[model samples]
Every structure is written in structure tokens, then in C-alpha cells.
Target chain A: MIQRPITVLMLSGLVLILLIGVTPAAAHGVEITYALTPVQTVRVEVIVHDLAGEPVRKADVTVFTPEVAPGDAPAAAEAELSPWLETSTDRNGWVSFVPDPALAGSWQIAVAVDDADAHITLPLAEESGLIRLASDQGISVMSSGLQVTVAATPITTIQVALHAQFDTGEAMDEAQVVVYAPDNPQDPFLTGTCDAEGRYAFAVDLGRPGVWEIQVRKAGHGDWLKIDLDENAIEFEEVPVDTAGDADSTNTTVQTVRLADEVARSVESDDGLSSGQIVLMSATTIWGFVGTALYFSRRRAATRPESESDN
Target chain B: MPRRFVTLVLIVLLLSSALIALAQAATGTLEFYANGEDFVRQGFVSKDGWAISFDHVYVNLTGITAYQSDPPYEPADEDAELVFDVEAILEGSYLVDLAEGDEDADPLLVGEVDAPEGFYNALSWEMVPVEDEESDMDGYTLLIIGTAEKDGEVIDFTLGIEQSYTYTCGEYVGDERKGILEADDYADLEMTFHFDHVFGDGELPPDDGLNETAPGFAPFAALAEDGVLVTDLAALEEQLSEDDWTLLVDILPTLGHVGEGHCHATLLDDVGETAE
Candidate 1:
């Protein structure tokens, strides 16, 4: 694996499950007590990527841990948050933080780049030697569900082939596909179904150059993609050109498609599946990826209580 | 041994579930903002080739609420009701100026509320006429004061609208995911306005969906006098051609959005009934 230089905010926030070493002769002789020491080292990894599954590197990452009153942590409502760590993402657009076992509470991370900002909150705590993350702050490490990945490939100047599939590498067969033209959003310009390979190819008349959207839905999940046709991408046949120069035409219409559960955009291309052909959707325009930051943590097994023999 | 293992597993499950429950029970601040985007803050050209610049654009909004939706909300879904676990409501109307800041300024804040910690994905807001009868902006939900120039002809214009709309939107999709409020942490949700929908963007292909539906500034420029045209939707409806007037009315409700995403804009009449 290639190691990219990403600034890491490692939060060592866990308790190492320790065995209870009790004195065997406590009933007849002197006894001793033990403290519940926090020794578990839990690491939370935050991955910030774009729709293309490419990492958004060099972005500034600011971590704000909830304020605790020394031994008496205030209630969530009365707590005032202060920045616990400030760092920038590495080349992989990721940061790693180990929760402060002493500070066992929620942590808020703000990753910013340019005009885009992604805030991810993870309620991390080291309790009873078990480290658990917030319910679901864009982290679904358990489910083997479908994750839709939309890729565009131009078949012709006006025609494009859009591919949709789960990150599990299964094609979204028979999924409903709806295309809405840039201007007429209320009505569908074209509607079709994906093949067994999750590919839906369609063609249209190039009357003008603008953004086009394709919404793909399967079962209860939905995902969408935006194709920006620029001047160099199409041949306009007797249509009025934009008089505002190329400045305004750069980003015509912005379409953001977030599906129901875990709106998956993680495209794992390791299975020989090609990815990031979105440039085929736009010639001059760059769809800057300002996406969600995923917070993930791997918990260790809890140690067994002391056996009777140890006592 | 199997029974003991099952009991231990059950206890762990209960403990973890309780921790998750405690995490979800926390509360946070959810900030709401109104953004005209660069299209209004910096101005743009109308589809008909008019370079426009704004001085002030005021909008009256009420019934602002955010929802923590499950199965998520899709505005494009027909008759889709927001199945939310919690809804954070800002219980008051507010008058906001979209063009109140510089080109690089942040969006204007509408208000903030103590909301449950969750992904407040879907949002809803209503645009009503200004309630103050004595103010110049009264009786209007939208007021636009701008200058449009095309082909050496300049027109100083103020477009006012008494029409009202209630926009129901899904999760905000833009440079980032919004409305994810952590305990004691704040997240922002925005109401984005696409003015290009009204006057058509001059920087796009003339046949683009947005420009095709918009009547552009050409029709409004025709209503100018002595390089000035200040009028309301009612006056423009009388002066503009039937097609242009109809298109203007169709575009006004669509002016509200959640970032680049569109909302289900329901036009309401004077009696707050859904207009035909």
C-alpha cells in the first residue's frame, strides 16, 4: 500500500481490559484494592473523499472534543466545546486520532478546503475497557449493503453511458434510471433500466451545452450523477450561445444526490473495476469534491473477569 | 458453556445499545442560513444577455423547520412525507437580505435552535409577504432591486412579489454534508436561492432546461422607462406577454433551493391555500 503524507490526529481513547488480580487469602489476611485503569488505545480514522472516491488531501482538519470538568464532566447541554487538536490532512485526505481516554465523550471534526466544509461528529468513549463510536456518523463498518457508484463514459458527443454498481462489485441490475434535463427538472427527459452489468447507455440531441442529471434507484436506495457538457464536448447546431462568456457556463447546475441509508460513495476499485471517469461528464468544469468525513474505529475484545482460581 | 456465552453476549449487547442510546440523547445547536449564492451576491447575466447587479434583495421566511429523517427525504418523490424521528423548528418569521454582504461573504444567518444530535437532513421553510404593513417591503415576500444592462441600454429595476411559497427540501447537497449536529457542537443548514431560475442564466446554453423555462430579462427590459423599471409581479404580469408572465410565475416558486438541490415549492394563495 502506498503511504500518503496525511496529517493524523490520533485519539488514543480506550481502556485496556485488565484482569482482576485478587489476593487468594483475602478472607483470612490483609486485602488490597485496585483501580480501574484506562489502558486501551482506540484509534479513530477519518477519511475525507470526493464523489470520485479520490481523497481530498491537504485539507485542514480541526478536532473539537467536548469540555469535561476535571472529574465532573458537565451534561451534554451545558458543555462548551474547545478545540482539542488542529491539523491538516495528508495526501490521502485522511486524519487519524486516538481519543483521549481521560476525555471520554463526543468529538467533532471540521475538515475544510476552499469553500467546502465537512463536519463529522463521533461520540467516542472508553467505557469498561470497550471503545465504541457514535451510532452512525457516516461509518457503516458492519453492514454488507449496496453502495451506488455512478460513472459516466461518453459514447458520442451527445450520448453517454452511465454505470451504477454497489461497492461490493454487484451491478445494479434492473434498477430504475431517470434522466432530467438541465432546464426541465420537473419532467424526465429519459427513463430506462440498467442491464445486468449496471450500465445504461442513452443518447440525446445536442441542442445546447449544460448540466444533465441521472437518478438511479434500486429497492429503497437512490443515487444520482451530474454530467456537465461543455463547449468542447458537443457540437451545437443553431442554438443561442451564452453571452456571459465562459465564466458562468463553467458550473451551470449543481446536483447533489444523497441516498437513503449511508448514502454510499466509497468506490473500491481493487476488483479490477475502473473508476473516476467522471471527467468524461465535464470538459471545462471541475466538480470539486466536498464530501462527508467518515469516522471509523475498531474495538478490541473485552477481557474476561478473573477466574475463581486466580482468587 | 453455550448458555454462559449467550448470556455474556446479551449483556454486552445491552451495554453497547445503552451507550448508543446515551449518545443519541444528547442535544446540539443547528444553525440555519439563507444564501442567495454568488448569483445574487456578485450578480450574473440573464439568459437574454443582460448583465445584472444587485443592490438589495430581501426575502421574508417563516415556518423554518429541520428534520432528522429516516429513509431520508426526496423532494422529487411524489406525495412523499418526511418520516422524521425529530424535527427542530424555529418558531418565528424572519426578514433576510440576500444581497447584504460582499461577494465573498458568508451566508446570512436566519436563526439557530437547540436540536437533537442527529443528521438533520430534510428542511422546510415558507416565504410569506412581509407582515409589517408600514414598511416599504410589506405585502411582499420577495423584493429585488438591481440594475440590468444589455446592448448599451441600462434598466434600474426592482421586482417585487406578493406571491408566497412553501418549499420542502431534502438533505443539502453541496461542497459538504450539512445538518450533522454533534452534542454541544453546531452544524449549519442553508436555503440557497437560484436567481438564474427567474431571469435565466446568460452564461448557459439558451436551450438549457433552466434558460428554457425562464423568460429572461428581455421581457422585463421591454417594460422599462427612462432606463428604469420598478414594478411588482402584478404589474409585470399586466405588461409582459402572456407567455413571459406565465413563465415568470412558474419560475418564482423554484427560486428556493437547498444548495444545488431543488425543493418541492408549493405556491400558496392569499388564504394560504395551495394555488392552482
Candidate 2:
């Protein structure tokens, strides 16, 4: 056999070098991180992560909002300097900001991750005055359940539309709807009942801009629901409801689909869904993250340790 | 156990004793005052009657003396008679009468009088009024004298008269029924009568009139001034032997006076000592 010492030496050297180099590389993985420059200035948060689904730390980052040019090409706009970027992340790899005179519109958080780059855009919108109520199946329902809304201006008048149904899911006409002052449950300001379509409309002069509660009950059934004026599932509009008939009809429901279409068409003539869109988008984003985190954590735990080792 | 019972008994006894002592202490005392003074001494009546005589002869002392027959029958006779001129002191109107004890004896007047209206006579043969006015000492002294005789010779003699008076105390002044010689409101009177005389008689009358012929006298009349007399010297001696005049003097203010409108007499026992 030819002398194998040289070959063995070469192999040992290669193995030793590989072990020495890979240890540091594995310990220092590519990470992408960004943080607000000033601390606690506005209600803004910055997040960064790597492709491996791990929080990226110590990443030089920049932020921009997307703008449209005349050529129909996307261009980067100079970010309006946020007032709340005075702090960096701690050892926990987290950063937060509360922008003074907070920024409006979309905020682009871009990160440089160990020679690789990624970005996230958070569409910042003003707080919504909208509230929605739906049945258990995720379809919006108007069947004897409560909905509430808050207003941006000092409220002068309040309009309430209700649809009541019985235990058999049949429309319950002539159900009494009483609007009470929120703090005092006994003083009912308005009393009315549903029509043949299980729909009731009440007009109330709120006297002042404040929270109120509406109570709906079928004449014979004990089940009733209360809707607070400032709850999350309703929309408060300053415009007259007749001006937004189509939107109102779309957002509202009666016993029949034909009636719902009529109502929507009536509400469509007014302003678009202005206040309700912000609240809906926020709710969607929050629920998306919550569902994603829950699924990721549960799926990670349920996978076998042997399967992960093989990967 | 016995000790406790004894203690209980002792406590009960102590309580009862204290209650008894408290009850006894609740009794009050009675004090008697004579007039306004506290001292009352010897008090009594004089000895004498309304008349006096010497035999059946009537004699007169034309110049305090008289002449009579031979050597054995000396003219200077020490046995003389005395009579009390009782009428001169009778300021209140009264009646008088005379009667003889026998045929040989001279007829004598011995009767009572009617006391004047609204007046009380102290000296009268009878009819003693409630009070005597003339005897009241407004710087006046009453002197009465008399004499008696039998067949031109001095024979058996008697001199007697009653000195009576009225007295008053507060609102009680006189008794209308009794003459002046009888004190009215007699329970309030304190009086004393004194007599001074010389008698050649054999024996004096008893002071309290225990012996016959010696009229017993009421030594002290509490209210009415009846003929309260001391008939003999022995009784007077017995009363005055002790120095009890201070007690009588102390009682004088309460007893007050009868006729004199003051103390009737200072020497209360002397009246009973010289009775005949």
C-alpha cells in the first residue's frame, strides 16, 4: 500500500479547520433587527425577524413608506421623521415607541439581516368608531343580539335599527326595544317594537355625547340583549342615515334578503364606510397574529422530537 | 361557721342598739318659767283676823298713855288691844256688819261686802274682789289700827283682820264671783302676807293650823289669793330655814303680783310666823 500518512494528515487538517470555523458561524447566525430611535414618544412599534422564524437582533434598519410616481412605478419616499425613536432594544430583542404627534398612514420597517434584507409595512390608521356583531358562524347577524358604536363628535341624535328572532330562528315581530340611559337602567327614553319584518328603528336625542344602552326584548320571551352606545361592534355616523342608505342596508339585515338589499341600496348613496374600515382592519390584523401565534406554538409542540431531529 | 353567725348576730345587735339610741334621743324636754324670771323663793300668808280687843273695856290713848287706879293696879298696862281699820283700804265698794260673840263681849262687825263694778277690793270683811287697787304700791302704804275694852279694865283682847287683794296675769285679771280676799285666776298668783305685832297671850296659833283654835292656812295659793296664811312660826321656820328665797324671787316674774302690781311681799315666810 502506498504510504497513507499524508492523506491521513490532510484529512485531519481539513476536519480540524472545519470544526473550528463552523462553531463560530453556528453561534452567530444572520439576524435582522430594527427599533425606534426615540423611546416612548408615540404609539408605534417596530418588529424584525429572520427567514428562519426567529427574532433578529442587532440589525441595522431603515423605514420608508411606499409612494406612487407618475410613471406608475413604486418609489421610496423619505420617511417623515417620527418623534419617538430615542431607544434601542434591550437583551430581550424587543423595541417599542410612542410617536409624539404620531405618524399617520403606512409605516415601513426595513431591516438589514447579516447581508440579507427584509421589510414589513404596518398600515397605521386612526382609531375607528365602528362596531360589528355577528352570529356564531361568522356571518353578520341581526337576530336578537346586541351591537354598540362610539362617535367622534358630540352626539346630537342616535338612530337604532334592530332585528329580533325567536328561538326557532324565525323573525320575532313586535318585539319591544327600549333605550335606557346607560348609568340608570330604569329610565327608558324610547320604547318601540319590531315591525312585520322583525325590524325596529328608534330615533333618540342623546341630549349630550355620552354612553347609552339599548335593550331589545321579544314580547313573550325572557331573552334580551343590551347594546352600549360605545361598544366595539357598532358604527356611529355623523351623517344622516338616509344619505347612506346603501351602506346602511348592506350593513343591516332584516328577515328577508330582499329587504337587506333595499336597505343597502339606501345606504349606498351616502359617504363610504369611513369610520368602520379602520376598526375592521385593526381587528383583522390582531386576530391574524393571534391565530398565527396559537397555531405555530401548538403545531410546534405537537410535532415529535424525533421528527425535528431528523430534519 | 360559728364565727360567721356570731358576726351576723353582733351586727344585728349593733343595728338594733343604734336604732334604740336614735329613738331615745328624739324625746324633748319641758321647761317652766315663772313670770320672766327663773328664781322663786319662800311664799306664805300673814297671821291675823279682822278684829282685836282687850277685855270688855274700851280705852283710848289720848296721848299714847292714860291714868288709872291704885298701886296694885298700875295704870301702865302693857296688854293693849289692836284692831285693823280694814275699811280704809277697801277701795272697791263693800258692805260691812258687826256681831257680838256674847252678852258681856262688845258687839263686833264681821261681814262681807259686794265688790264694786269694774273694781276689785283687796281689803274687806268679805266679798273678796278679783284684785285690790289701794294696796297697789304706787308709793303708797296702807296702815290699819284699832283697840277694844271691857268694863273699864283691860280684859281679854283680840286683834285680827284679813288683807285681801286682786291680781292679774296677762289677760286673766279677776274672778267676778269671789270677793277681793279671794284671788281670781288663782292658779297664776304668788302672794305673801306679813304681820308684825306684840301679844301677852299664852301661845300662838299653828302655822299650818294643825292645832285646834289655830286656823290652818294655805301657805301658797298658785293662782287665787284666798285666805292663804301661815298660822304658826314653826311652819314659817320650816319654809324659810333653807335659803330658797332666790328660787321664789326667780319665780316672781311668772307669778307677778296681786294688789301692788309688783311682788306682793319679799318676806313670804314671815306672814305665817306671827299668827295669833
Candidate 3:
């Protein structure tokens, strides 16, 4: 569905997560000490406005609290979620609702101003006593772009995993992959195809440090990612960090961010894929590091993102 | 050509052919649609008691692109940051009449594209003036020719809106989920325009948000001249009062939706009549 600009209604509020523990019952050599974890509730102040910054008066405001606390959300099925409270913004566009204070995470808030509608996310911090979350766990600069083999390990040489997935939750398996060095944008640097997983792997010759471009194209659709490699390390440039497609197709979310961080740590602590080859390429006297090993560190890839994500 | 050069050319050709084959194997077709809903087809009474029926509702669309997202794009998320790599784009401009079929007609099909197989959850569309000033729809993005009758009096009306809008949305939110394509399979997405939001549904309460925001056919009927009215938003703005003009402009952006879902719409200032 197209989104109504109701997002002009900015929701800001003070929030806290609370966990209440019931006293354990002990009777004649038996002990019941299980702690009951309730959902979280945080107070919020919602201010609805039009794009012109004028407060929208008498608008209907409703908030949908998360049915389960963070880390406790059901893996597969969505529980029956319902509206927490139904209220109206005052003349000043000021309206506040305290959720039953149960779940600790993000809550959904909707406002119907005049006839236009808006839906906003009310962020609840993790510290707000949100039902003491279960343990949860991504890589170095490791989100949706290539890695320079610099963030984690100390090797000059590196490997890149270029991922091509434009639609939400789906892989661009077998996409056409092409590489272009900064020196020649018109001619091809390297030509190849992605594996069945929409990923193309290649070793970045950091020894030949220069800005490199990788393009993943399929059917008439394609995108470009820019990689800058210098003496300090590899830095991603002009890469889109957000996405356009958000369908529930993959049933899994790729943690591109921190993927690099994780890879870096792994190299420092020795985790994930095995490290490979150290070729001694003839070096230029000014910048000579011919013996730096090339290890297979994974990288994230994306180029075009939706305009909405730009903000 | 020398043997070394000839051998290199052969290798390049073979590699290109292999990549093309791989792309074909991973692709499918995705279709795009536009729907004016029952208000434009079956016709409905405006909240002000005007019976309105459309003979033609032409909308021009362009820049249609579809994409797959990792976290699943929620068009409703205000602060969402979207990321995507490859995506399907339906290039060129297209014009479709929402009143082409009968009352129970299916949504109008705009076009289709060969896309990589993925769960395409997000889409974008734009409405611009038809090309060439000589054409009937030229210089106008939206054209509505309809009839409205109230209290035994009939008025033939032609409402031409020069305003343009770009609607980017996430997912289809109707009976069944759409835009899920498998290799060799076909999927579809829809761009829905809720005319009721502009005319107001008489079935709904007078106090309803849609009705309150809509200017209703009553305002247009009052602007009718000798049982026939053909005018644009500029003329209407001058003829209608300040409150009515504001109400109409506010309602215009609310016209587009995705199967009961909302879209993020931007009124293009550089195109058409250059609306304020």
C-alpha cells in the first residue's frame, strides 16, 4: 500500500521499560521461584502536524503496542495484535498515551488528521526495564557493502562478497557481475556471474590501491557499488545503506552492518572461513607491501535504495 | 586479426553469453496495475447527496520500479531507511482509463517487466502530463469526465487536474499478498486511487474523516455553468472560497493508496500546472 504522509505526525515521548517480579511461594519443602515477566509500557507525547508544520487539530490517534517483548517475539506466527488505546489529538496536536506498559520494543502509532493518515513508530529504549531480554546477537563495517579486509585483520590484501538482492527477502541468484577499476570506467575490469546465492566473490588487490566499482545486473535491473582502497584501509563510498523492498520473503534478515566488525574480530580471534594465499606481486618503490596475505573476508553489497530511506 | 587478439575476443564473448544465460535463468515477469476502485467504476453518491458517475477517468503513470528489501519495506514506517541493490523497472510512460471495464472490472493493467525472481515488496509510480500538447490528456496528469445529478437536476462535468504526484509504496495490502515472484512465475503489484477520498462516500457518516476532508460534488456543482462545467483547479481555486480550496487540495494527495494501504505521495511542483 502507498504510505499516507501522515508521518508528518512526529511522535516523541519519555519512555521506560519495567519488569515486575512476584514473590516466590514456599510451602513445606517445595519452592516456586519463577519470575513472571510482563510486557513493557513507556509514556509518550505525540505531536501531529502537517507538512507545513501546522498542528493538526482533532485528529484521531491510536497506538498499537507490541504483543510480545523484544527477544520474546514468536519466530513464525504473529500473535493477535490489537489497538492499545484510541484517543484524539487536542487543538495543539498534542496527545499522549501510556501503553499498558507491557512489551519493551517499538510500538506502532497511527493518526488520522483531517482525512490524511499517518503511521509512526514509537521507539522504546532497551534500558526501560523491558522484560529482561534473552540474549541476542552482525560484522566490521559489515553491513550491505564490500569490506576492505582492514576493519578486522591487519592484512593488506582482502576478499569481497558482492551481494545482489533488490527485491525484499529474495536473492538475485545468478546475477551478471562486472568489475571496473577507477582507471578505466569504459572498459571492463573483471567479468563474472554470481553464484546461486546472488553473491560474487573476488580478491581485492589492495596492493594496487585505487577506487573500484562493482556492478550486479540481472534482466534489465542493475546497481553499482563503489569501493575505495588506500594505504590506511578500505572505505566504502557512495553505497546505499537502506533498501526498497521489505516483503516477508526471506524469513531472515541480513545483518550487513557489523558483518565487517564481526569479520575483523574473527580475523583477530580466528573465526569463520579459512584465510588464504599471500602472493608477492612486484611492488612500486613508493608503496610496497608485496607480502600482505589475501584472506576471504565477506562484504555486504547494495547501491540503489528508495528515496524514503534517504532521510 | 592476430591469433592472440582473436582468442581474447572469443573468451569475452563466451563469458558474456554465460552471464546472460544466468540472468535469464533467475528472472520472471512482474506486472503493474492501477485501480480507481468502485467509485470510478460502479459510481457512488457524494457525501453531499450528489449521484456521480464517471464516463472516463484517465491517469498517466511513469517511472514504475519494484524492489526487494531485507527488513521488508513498510510504507507506513516514517523513519525507515530502505536499502536495495538490483530491482525491476517498468520504463516509459503509460496512460490507463480506470473506467474502461464494467462495474465489476478488474484493476487496469499498466505494463509488465522481466525481473529477477524475488519477493518484490516495494514499488514506485508517477503521474505526469500526457506527451504532446495536441493530445486530449496533454498538459494534464488526471482527467475525469463524469455526470452528477441532484434533486432532479443534471450537470455534465469535466474536471481536469494538472497536478502531478509520485507515489512510492511498500507491498500490496489487500485480500492476498502480492509481488512474490518465483523463477518462471508471474507476480503483480497495484497502484490504487481512492476516488471516494476525493468525492466522499455517501455510505459513510457525514462526520467521517474522508467526508470532512472531501470538497464533495456539491462544491463542483455550484461551479457548474448552464448544466455543463469544464474547469481546472486554478479556475476552481478562484471560484471556490478559501476553505473549500484548501479542503480540495488536501483531499487530492489522499487519492492514491495500495489496496487499503497508504502511499508516500509527493506533489511534483515542476510539472503540470505547478500546484502550490
Candidate 4:
């Protein structure tokens, strides 16, 4: 009876002490959670803390998500001092992001607080409450019966990429892709055909902030994503490179195999003429015109004297 | 000198002169003008002892054509066999405000046309309600806003007429003689819009001339008295009976000057000199 009483008292005391220590641990860890919305927007949140178990305010958190198809290995998540959708933790050590459809994927959030970095990849589970991870690969075949995904980045020119596959799990290429504002459905603001890779990547200048829809169709099946735009959605804060700390102090990287190599290689032929190539082409054409004009003028001048002498 | 060289030099000079002349005679300009006459507001005396004054007079004028006659016309001949070839002129509606007497304003110059250089003898124009999608002016071509006073009572009238009339050279020949156009000339034709003709008598609506059976001016006149003011077209339509609206429609064409181009043209003799 005496042993039992003493053991119960010691166990109760240890439990009380652990509960008291848990409060500090909770405030000292930077935790991030996110939801990959079916509407093609990524909702991300980050809770940051200091070593002393205090909420670290304004800690820079850079989230990088390399867009990859289902079953493909994500590229190495390098420590980017200026990631795409970056934000700072508030007084509650919390920061969130509902990234635009252009930035939807398995986002790797890299948090740097007090020269220490932490990373997390969302969504955390195959079937989280917000993201329905139906595939071992992070492929979300939406309930709209379209096996396609949309990804975007908050750049001056929003780069949107569409990855589509047929019901037979084959890449659907040369699909008819149309993007337009809902209010102006008749005017297909952007219309193009998907390449042989079942990928259509294009840059659009979102002149105004409003909801836009993308429609991708192959055969008779189609996929759509409603993109919401706002001031917070189109802008990002770059992560600061802490020159005062160790260079490799917070070089944390996290990646998830998102899509298959077959899907990724299918869109390998998507490279088109770059802006520099276009400029070079225009210059060459102009020089060719000048050279042709000079040659013809010289020939005409040389022939004029012979004609004059004959006359 | 060789005959061939002389012939070649003459041919070059002749060809150059002919080309220059053809280039010079390529186009002729016609300027339109409005004549409010003595029947304008503030000074006009109606036949029925009422002192008449017009505020606004809007007329839709169209189908203005210049004609090439085989022989020139006599203004006062008893019988003249006149044949004319129609030349295209300006076609548009113009608001002729009797009160807007500014010479440099747009109201003064109704329209202007650039035509090919040719001798034009007869001018024909129609004062008609617009029947085209180009304008909303229909039924009555002219809208006359005026006030008449006799004794102590004042009558404010919005006289509407839906009549369409084509006035050729004969209708405009009397009094003011026009219908001659010179090549490379700028013709300035002054159209006379007589407000006195609208109201035959000083009567609120003249009793005669305007047919009253189907639709005419007499019924519109019966709708008003010597003291009431009719404001706008909507107000007039609201105040008048349905039959009176039909009468207004019938009388609209007959309200203003049927001979729209009651004019005299100042033909240009030289490039800058005007033949008065």
C-alpha cells in the first residue's frame, strides 16, 4: 500500500511537470499547415518561435513549390533567399498563404528565425481535411471529373501551367485550352492548344484583379479551375539572406516526389523562342534588309555608266 | 527648226496644260446657308393681327440635288419646257433655329458638298421627315417654337408638321433666281425658312388649307387657346387628344416652307472672286 501511494504521487508529479513544460515547447517550434484548394489556390500558414519559447514576430518564411506532374521527383529545394510566396510570422508566430492558382503544388515552406531554419511540405497526409490527396503522388483529380491540375506563380507576368491526363492515365496532348473571365464567357481571353506533353504554359498580364477561369478539354472531357486574385495573392515578400549568421546555418531543404517521370518528360518539348532569341531575329532581319538595299544600289550605280556610254 | 521637234514641243506643252486644267477642275464646293427672313421671332407680324415671334425652328432637309439643264430656264415665262439631269448633292437634317443668327455658327451653315466641276442649272431639295436609320427625326420635318400675342393674351405654340415636299428649280425660281453652277466654283445657296407660312392666319391653328379629315393642322389648333403654353413634344402629345396627334402628324409637313431651298446662289467666277 505504501509503495503504491508513493509511486502514484511520483507519477502525478511527473505528469504535472511535463504539462508545465509543454507550454514552452509549443511556443518554441515553427509549425506550418496548408490546404491545396480544389479551386486551384494554396492556403499556407506558419507559426514561428524563438529558442526561449517566445513567439518570434516578423520571422521570414519562404515557401517554394516546384511545379511537377504526378509521380515525378521534385527538384532539389535549394535555400532560396527570395522564394515565390514568402511572408513573415505575426505576433502570434503565425503566417498564412492562399497562393494563387499559378502557385498550387506541394509547397516546401522554409522558415528562417534567428539564423535557424525549418521546413515542411504540404499537404501533410494523403487525405487531409482541405487537400484530398487521392494519389501516392500529390495528384488531386478534382470531383469535376477532370484529371488535370493548374499551377501559378505571383510574378508580374503570371505563369500558369496546366497538366492534364486522360482517363486511361495517358497524357492528353493537343487539348483545347481556353481561359476567360466568367463575366465575359464568350470572349476566350486566352485560347491555345496543349502541346504533345499535355502541358500548356503561358504568361498572362493580369491587368486587373478579378476572378479568372481556365478550361482544358480533350476529346469531350474538360477540366476547369477558378482562380481568385487579390492584393495579397499577387504579391510576395522575399526571404532575407542573413549575412550576419553562418552561411550554412539554416540551409534546410524539403521535397516530395510529386509526379511521375513519364508525366514530367512528356512536357519536355515545351521550350519555345525566348525573348532574347526574338530580339536577335529582328536585328538580323533588319541588317539583311540594309545589306540587300546596299548591294542593289551599288549594282544599279555600276550599270548606269555602261548604259550612259552605250547611249 | 524641224517640224517634228516643233510638234513634239507643242504636244508636251498642250498635254501639260490639259493635265493641269483637269486637275484644277476636279472638284467644286457648295456651301449651305439658312434665311430666317422677316417672319422671325421678336419682329414678325402674322396675318391675323398677332405679333408672332419664333424661338426655335428645326427642319430636316434632304434629297438636295443639282441638275444639268439642256437649255437655261426663264423665271417668268408662261410655258417653258425644262429638262434636267439630276446631280447628287448633300442629304442631311439640319436644325434651323430662327433665333440662332450667328453667321460663324454651325446653325448658319447647314451642310457643304464637294462635287465634280460641271454646269448645274436646276437645284432640287426636299423638306421631309427622315425615313432612315441615320436620324430619329420623323413624322414632322420642322418644329417651330414661337409665341403669339394679340390684345393682352399670349399663346405659346409648339407647331409640328409631318409633311414631305420636294422643291425643284421651278418652285425656287420665282423672286430669288439660282440654279447655275460654274466649274471649280464655290456656290453659296441661302435657304429661306419662312415662319409666317406655318400659321396661315393669326388663328391658333389656321382653319384653311390644312386638311382636317384624317390628320391636319386645324385639329392641333383646336387643342389650344390664346393663353395656354405648350412646352415640348411630350407635353403637346400629353395635352392633345389622340385625334389631334394624328392631325399634328398630318399637319407636320405643311407647317414650314415646302420649297426648302428658297435660295440665291453666289457663283464663283474666278478661284477667289465671287459672281454676285
Q: What TM-score, computed on C-alpha atoms, does each candidate reach?
A: 0.49, 0.15, 0.47, 0.33
User: Could you give candidate 3's per-residue lDDT for residues A1-311 as a string of tens digits?
Assistant: 33432211111111111211111111100010111111223335566666656776777665555543433222211352334445676788766543433345655655665557655544454442232222221111111111101111112124454555544324566666566555554344455565566655554444445555555555323444444443212232221111322222222222123211211111111111111211111112111211111111111113224443785
Which residue window of length 10 is worst by lDDT in model 2 chain B? Answer: B61-70
- Is candidate 3 or 4 superior in lDDT? 3
lDDT of 2 by residue, A139-244 (tens): 1111112111111121123344455554344465655555544444333444444556565544333333333334334421212223323321233222212222
**Residue lDDT tens for model 4, A114-210:** 6565555554222211232223443222212112122222222244555555533445577666665434533445455555767655433445444
Computed on C-alphas against the true complex, the DockQ of each candidate is 0.01, 0.00, 0.01, 0.01
Q: For candidate 4, lDDT tens digit of each residue in B1-276?
A: 245444544555565556545544555686666656554534454545667666676676666665544333221122334454335477765655656653333326677787654445445566656455564344555567767666766777776555455444422212222333345767555555544444443443434331122242333444566565544445567767886665544333322221332222222222324433
If you assessed candidate 4 against the hidden native complex, which CAPRI class would it receive?
incorrect
| Candidate 3 chain A worst ten-residue window by lDDT | A26-35
Residue-pair clashes per candidate: 19, 87, 45, 23
Mark the regions of model 4 whose C-alpha exceeds 4 Å error after superposition: A1-311, B1-27, B41-43, B71-82, B102-107, B116-119, B130-139, B171-177, B201-222, B229-276
Ranking by lDDT: 1, 3, 4, 2
TM-score of model number 3: 0.47
Runs of candidate 3 with Cα error greater than 4 angstroms are: A1-311, B1-24, B77-82, B271-276
Candidate 2's residue-wise lDDT over B1-276, tens digit each? 345445545655565556544433322211111121111111112233222321211111000101111111100112212111121122223221112133333222222222111112121111121123553211111121223222332222222222222222111111111111211212112121112112111133533111222221212221112322322222333453233323322222222222111221112122323122
Off by over 4 Å in 1: A1-311, B1-25
Ranking by TM-score: 1, 3, 4, 2
For model 2 the local lDDT of residue A37 reads: 13
lDDT of 2: 0.27
